[model samples]
Target: MAGGAADNYGGVFDGSMGFGAKPALILIDFVEAYFDPSCALYAGVEEALKNALKLRDAAREAGLLIVYTNVSYTQSMIDGGRFAQKVPPLENFVAGHPMGAWPKGLEPADDELVITKHYPSAFFGTSLASTLTANGNDSLIITGLSTSGCVRASCVDCCSHGFIPIIAEDAVGDRHEAPHKANLFDMQAKYADVLPSAKIMEYLSELKL
Candidate 1:
């Protein structure tokens, strides 16, 4: 028998996209803006950040292709586009801004792909799809800040691109607990598998490499 909220959805949008053989790691917008208490966009996500570090380390050890996404805009912010307009806080990503850099210890390796975008989904107007394709990465292990925003968009786009999206629930954070929990439930029900960080780390560790 379906239980409570599970029954309310009428059995729709309830299936896993599952894992693909070639997995890649995508760290979305894990920058100073979202982590710094002094910054306007800060979310007080230290716990999540620490877990993400563990995930990153596991990915590195497992030899997975690591991809990190951060927003960047012209000094004029003209290239920020509509999404930026809707959320003016995006200006924090402008060139030369203090918050534009990756949070300490979360920095990308010199050889890792660093994708910069002006929008929500990392794939939009970016070379992420082709990069993933070129590297033979068919699954995305995703983490980062603001669960209701960029993280959600990136996962949906990952699914649309035929890449399996595996969202590490403990590795993603939101400024508020409500949206974070809600989006995780919604993504698990529809777009992706929301798993604990330890499970994800174990999966990566057990890969053939």
Candidate 2:
């Protein structure tokens, strides 16, 4: 049965921003902390990573500009500010920490851009918005860790910066299913066009290089 909430929000939040003429694929914070079982921030989201890799491959084949983000902080953790205080595990991203490193296959190519951010949103305190604008990208295909946190934040900022945000639903994961699903639903309703990774791959396949 369809949920009453979906019915309640029908038409109001069902609009789609759709894909744009120039879309960039941003693989956000696919770092070792979320992948390593022993890490405090481990999300056990291997499937999300797998799907994101597929998206990355499709974007590469489509010749779309690809961007990657990772959180980093100074050794003193001073730059992290209250965010670090709120989530002590963020120390995992301090410079030279193994958890801060990219996992095996997710490393950015030499020519690809990598943005280091101190906050949840990739655009905050980073060159992402300017870089995207300079590259002539009109939309962003966002995929990343923790749907309720960084992914949601980035999606909102992506829209606020005048770019259409297309979220790869299966390409983002949280520590639990509830926040993940809730954030996806919320983002779909308010900030982005949340579509399955396969759908996004299809879109990429149809794009002209």
**Where in model 2 is the C-alpha error above 4 Å?**
1-4
- Model 1: weakest 10-residue lDDT segment is 1-10
User: How high is the CA lDDT of each candidate model?
Assistant: 0.88, 0.93
- CA displacement after TM-score superposition, residue 93 of candidate 1 (Å): 1.2
RMSD of 1: 2.1
Model 2: per-residue Cα lDDT over 1-209, one tens digit each: 26986788888888988889999999999999999999989999999999999999999999999999999999999999999999999999989999999999998999899999999999998999999999999999999988999999999999999999999999999999989988998999899999999999988899985
Segments of candidate 1 deviating more than 4 angstroms: 1-5
RMSD value for candidate 2 = 1.4
Backbone collisions counted per model: 0, 0
Candidate No. with top TM-score: 2
Candidate 1, residues 99-190, lDDT tens digits: the string is 98977888788989999888889899999999999999989999987899999999999999989999999999999999999999999988
RMSD of every candidate to native, in Å, equals: 2.1, 1.4
